[model samples]
Target: MDIQAVDRVGMILALFGPHRESVTSTEAADLIGLNRTTTYRYLNSLVNANVLTLREDRTYVPGPTLVQVGTYAVGRRDVLKVAAEPMQALARETEITAVLSLWGAASPVVAHVEEPPRLEVVVSVRVGMQLSPVAAQTGIFHGFMAGAPSVVRAAREMDDADRERLQSSAHATVRQGYAAQVSSRGIAVLAVPVWDTHGLAASLALLTTRDVLDVETDGPELAALSRTAETISRMLGSTRPAMTG
Candidate 1:
């Protein structure tokens, strides 16, 4: 590999941090400590290569090529193969949508989703859709993913209360071995961590309409979700104890 070219590419890519979605040539030049002409040439090369897009305002953002590469990488994970049948059974048994998600650049991205057969009003989730890490519905990912603390810190415009709430949710998730939340949209989500030998592998979540979730007096739905997650964890070679939460 050409070291200088690799370094310049890495610097250019680093400029698109969570807080900085797009960058102009001058801005990237200053941040990357390169001359303006050189930076502009590099940006143009990236745009031509389809790694970055040149917007009308001359700012650069991640292009379709990068998204396609990310989607392809997500699809190649072995965990998706292990999770397929369990996720399907979870959706069928609970009559709720089941999602398998792995941590992505900014949040957890859905790798696979299974919708109930009779579900008329389907949830809009799809494979490769990025989910909010701070949202109550996605606490499991932030709670267990290795790089979650830095991601929480990088999240912009969060109030003190919101930060505290997210921190509390993470703690609760670890303590209980799972996380649950009822969104203001009247959507209920329950998530359990899937572990491999290395540690937390991913999150398995069940999504249901609030009405149906509220009516379930018995704990069977939650039990089923936990069982499925545990099965996946075992298949991934995890020997961790069963989730008590």
Candidate 2:
């Protein structure tokens, strides 16, 4: 409405940055040269509209509703239902361990994981179990470790330079058709990105554990995973899923 208001909102957005999680009203005011009272007024209005989110401690983050709306607006297509059968088939063939995961904001949750028939080797996961974004052997963290888009957003919690290095590795993970543990007791996972024919859509990945992967230096299994991802993609009507390379 006013010049002062416009300038303050612009400055506040810049401060929000990619990695900084939350900011205080007083801190925003001081940084942007607005009085604390004025800053609180603007922040309160944003919070009420659900444009911004505030914690119990009064710190702020991008609101949940806004995020969901933004993602949908960004044209992300959901492909899980189409991917289920293929995922099950892969698990059935290998009889090792496999999972499908997605980002749940702060962490990764196992959206779907196959139950191993061996009972003992079975790795159980639920609809919503949060995991680290950087762990090499786990859910969404592994997704991020494997370079999933969901994890890429979480990795923005780091500074730009550090984030750049990780993003490079993330891209590599997507291209390589598998993401490997830095060291083992190695838990290697083979993955493939399945996409809708439309370029602007969500992705699905097929995940398999270290055992089946260990038998391979030639990467035939990895290629199979890629093929599986492709099959899933075609089923979803994606004539062109985004290529890794």
Candidate 3:
């Protein structure tokens, strides 16, 4: 492999972060420290190769081929493989939906979902859905992923107050091993971190009605979730100590 070619490709990909969904050739050149002519050539070559898409506005975004590659990579991850059975059992035990999410370009994306039977009004979640980075529920990722600081910085432009809230939420998630939020629709979501030897691999979450998660009554449910996450982490060779509330 030609080292220069590899470096150029890597730089091109790195230019597309959570904040930048699309970029013009000039912007890409400036960001990557390449000349405008070289940037245009590289961008066009990527577009031809289906690694990126050129928009009508002359900007570029990740294309179908990148998405296809990402989906395949997510599917083959060991964490998802180990999480399958435990996630299903979690949904069954709590009668709530179980979600497995991974950090993506701008936020957490659902990598897998399992819904419980006999739930009259369960929340609907699908694989590949992107959760809001600013939402309190996603603090689980912010607290654990090694790339979390960069992700947070790129996901959205925020004021000081918003930054403070995000920091506070992340700190709380670190202390409790999980994060919880009530949706506007009255659905409550609790999420726990799943670790790998490399750091945060993903998040395992339970989604249920607000009424089902009474603080006084859901102790066992919370414990079960934590244990399940620890089991998954162990399967992935994580040696981190178990999280405690």
TM-score head-to-head 1 vs 2, winner? 1
Q: Model 2, stretches more than 4 Å misplaced?
A: 1-78, 103-109, 135-153, 159-165, 174-178, 182-185, 200-212, 215-220, 241-245
Off by over 4 Å in 1: 1-42, 48-50, 53-68, 146-159, 215-218
- Ten-residue region with minimum lDDT total, candidate 2: 199-208
The C-alpha local distance difference test score for the whole of candidate 3 amounts to: 0.79
Q: What TM-score quantifies how close candidate 1 is to the native fold? A: 0.75
C-alpha TM-scores of all predictions: 0.75, 0.53, 0.75
Residue pairs with backbone overlap in model 2: 77-202, 196-238, 197-238, 197-239
Per-residue lDDT over 208-227 for candidate 1, one digit per residue giving the tens place of the 0 to 100 score: 77777752332778789889
Candidate 3 matches the true fold with a TM-score of: 0.75
The per-model lDDT (C-alpha) reads: 0.77, 0.57, 0.79
- Candidate 3's residue-wise lDDT over 12-129, tens digit each? 8766654567999999998879999988998899999999999999999998898798779877899888898988888888887888888765567788888887877777677777
**Top-scoring candidate (lDDT):** 3
RMSD (Å) of each candidate, 1 decimal: 4.7, 7.2, 4.6
Q: Please, what are the lDDT tens digits per residue for candidate 2 over residues 1-245?
A: 79977766656655553345589999888877888998899888778878789899989777766677756743453555665677777666666455665545444445566654554655444544554444432321433344555455557666777566555655555555444443244455544455555432222333334554653453555555556667776887878533433
